[model samples]
Target: MATICISTVLNFRLRKPRGFCCSLSSHDKMKNNNKRETPELLKIAVSGITELLRIFSSSKDQRLDTVTYTQKDQPLVSGIEDIVDILQSDYENAYFLTGNFTSSIYAEDCSFEDPTIKFRGKDLYARNLKLLVPFFDCPSLSLQQIQKVVSSDKSCVLATWKLRTYLKLPWRPLISIEGNTVYDLDDDFKIARHAESWNVSALEAVGQIFTPGT
Candidate 1:
């Protein structure tokens, strides 16, 4: 698991510059946001492992994208260390390519469609995890949920740490070594953070977002 995870993360950099842009947008939101003179409904990118595995295999071992946390900047968060323990212990799952289900990973010309997965060992739930990532300019965002959020909204982007509130979201952390330390928040007034983010960039490099596109 450790070798696989490391190889996977390092492979996100092998893409040609054009590879980073999503098929849905003309360019990354930073560059293309200006060309469109009118407001458009945002088509958000949700994380999925299938694509990350592909991307990592193709990306020649470069460090995967870094996401600055909102909690690193906030002084109010307390008792957060236990958050890591909860995640590492309670969450456990594995990612595998869905045979030939790769064509539908990204939606067709106009929709934000995501793939479908079958997990029955535990109940699954969905929610929106609002993140203050440096790479993004949007105020709110979403992550495809793999757990039940009986107490949270679909609007909140997830963070490893808690902000004003957190839904006790479930996380299936990757197995790893060398560093199990959770990232500390940056100095940028970090408010909230995701308790878990499955690293899936490697899967994307090879166009394995989701073959079936369900």
Candidate 2:
């Protein structure tokens, strides 16, 4: 449960109506009228503040029974559990490498970028993953950390991960890369953009030519 406290200050100014026979110029009278309107301005300000307090109070009541994640709950994101499940099954699921992600978790116009490629549209993204699947054996993606950010119109998930696999060369060296990925979700909560950063360069990855145990 969350609590909100609102403090309001009220300012009052009392003014008596001026006589029409006053000798002051029109400009002077206008200034006096403006001074008299301070109470009205304060009324508007108080109304706005009251409405804001009401809104906050209502929101707190509605969320009282719900569990909210604070900064202490690191690596938290809405719908992240499902996304993790999908990623964990990706190595064994041909559909994940093919087009399943397109209709399931990704927006049709999603964009994806990594060290080697940058592209938009779910179809092309799925195609790229399919093409890369054949060059690796026993690939695994493990999530090391996750963080969620909510904004006015969209939400994002940042994940630190490690990808482990053996390149299908004659030596079949075991290669492991630590990387981070940012996934942006659209209004419907489908992945709209995905970008990855790797700790090692592509050339460095290619240099791992010998099997680890050999």
Query: Which sections of candidate 1 miss by over 4 Å?
Result: 1-78, 93-191, 195-206, 210-214
Error of 1 at 153 (Å): 28
Mind giving the per-residue lDDT tens digits that candidate 1 earns over 90-208?
A: 22211111011111111122111111221111101110111111111111212222211212222111222111111111222222211011122222312122222222222332232
TM-score for each of the candidates: 0.20, 0.51
lDDT of 2 by residue, 153-194 (tens): 556665556666665656556666665556677766677777
Best by TM-score: 2
User: Alpha carbon lDDT of residue 193, candidate 2?
Assistant: 77
How well does candidate 2 match the true structure in TM-score terms?
Answer: 0.51
Per-candidate Cα lDDT values, in order, are 0.21, 0.45
Worst 10 residues of 2 by lDDT: 6-15
The residue-level lDDT of candidate 1 at 139 comes to 18
Model 1, position 23: C-alpha lDDT score = 27
Model 2 spans with C-alpha error above 4 angstroms: 1-102, 209-213
